[model samples]
Target: MEAYVTIVAVAPFFLRLLKLLTIVLTSALLALPVYAASSPEQTLGLIRHTFRSHRPPPPFVRYTLTRRQLTNEGFPDFIWTYTYHIWCRTSDNAALGRRVFRGGSYGSLEFLRPTFNAATDPGPPTADLFEPAPATKQATPAPIFDRLREIGGVEALGETDYQVLSAVTEGELIHVRLLPRREPERNRLRELFADRRTYELKKAVATDRLFTQFQSYPELYTLTLGAAGGYPVVTAIHGVVDDSTFDEAARYIDYTFTEISFPATMPDWYFEPSGYGAHAKEAPQ
Candidate 1:
């Protein structure tokens, strides 16, 4: 009986020691810092450097724009999200342009377009033609760029002033910027692009699983410029789904960024200080 009693007392002490050792081992494993994972900024910097390193001769310049989705959380009813972004270009032949990164967020389950409030005369016939009307003094038509200009930080670049810079990689995106007007006229044009395609996230499961937990998916587009100051710009459009997964999002992002184009005639609707496709034809340097 004494021997059994002693064994029972020792067992508790041994178990305590085992638990102590286990905790020490776990801490040691965690303490060894894993290889420094590249930050989004570092990844972006590497892309700019890589583009310059490969081009012929010294004194060459490059530029890159990174748009990323910073926050994406899936909820039972909806997905809440936001993006932070940055743009960097070469300043001199060898000097890299300082990166300008900004962060912002947006919510979209159902977005409503702001009502058009006409303020003044529609003005002379513009790029998109309008028919003549009787001169009755109603409020004039709002300037085409009015709404766009309202959003801050739009820079106007003159045509021929900037050229295509370089082609950046797919991984540089870490921040995202919300482009004004979620439903633009360009969306209609996108429907016509022969290259444009859609993917259906179809999963065949056992009949028991009828409750399809849906999450929103993003569509990506990458535009690479051919000239000196030009850089790649990524755009994404997203919607909710009843049966989609993160893997589907990865595929959509890959395909979308791979194919987009610059229009032949710059639309006034996308003019500078408001739109992403800046450097319109009218503005002079």
Candidate 2:
């Protein structure tokens, strides 16, 4: 086994194929929009075509949790929402969707991309947004800070036990890469993965903006949601190919087949009753 391992390691090129595919895919995504979609049915059909077609075997789907948000509910305020943007790829297409789910009892989907974090922080801030903190105050925040603080500050993600990646954004929209602490030989490769995820999310947002403004859908396109629980709490749009013309864009990355399955967590507010007196109330003395 050791000899075989050594032989494989010494092979002229071990990651050549993976590197090539990644380069090709990344270039394709960058050149065009992440993907374009007309509707859920239309989008799923395209995935089927892309993967089941003959050009190349379908690759495994990959997902990245770009951002999350939450919101408050009625009396007792037991509910909390969560929205997530998960990205994946098909043989010749990028597949994406959004889902919104509620938390707590008697909740319901308020809108697509369940309001994960409260629209605004209701609690007091550990520190001010822009101004510098007083010298006497501690630099770090308390155990629980508002969503803005969490989003504004650097966030480190982990895989199992080890820290895999970290991300920070300059503008609320654009994703910025931070230096990695680990200095593995394959550090660059890992960074590329992070970059790709960020690019996908960014392009998804751009595609949605175009759809709303231009009313034009690219040939190779997909749309997915970021869900708080089960529904499209937040939706993302992507166009795999969008060159000068539709035909040109279709050439590089075109897919006709795909399928995806994901678990949907029930939103906390779904079962919650609405109105001030929806539930039985004690009579005032």
**What is the model-wide C-alpha lDDT for candidate 2?**
0.27
Candidate 1 residue lDDT tens string, 1-285: 999999998999999999999999998776442322134233223222333333332222122222222222322211212221111111111111122323332221111111101121111101111111223322223222211112256422221211222212223222211121233312111110100011100110000011113522232322221222232222222222223544334232110122222223333332123432243343221
Q: In model 1, which runs have C-alpha deviations exceeding 4 angstroms?
A: 36-268, 271-285
For model 1, the run of ten residues with the poorest summed lDDT: 199-208
Task: Please give each candidate's TM-score.
Answer: 0.18, 0.17
Candidate No. with top TM-score: 1
Model 2 misplacement above 4 A: 1-110, 113-210, 222-238, 241-285
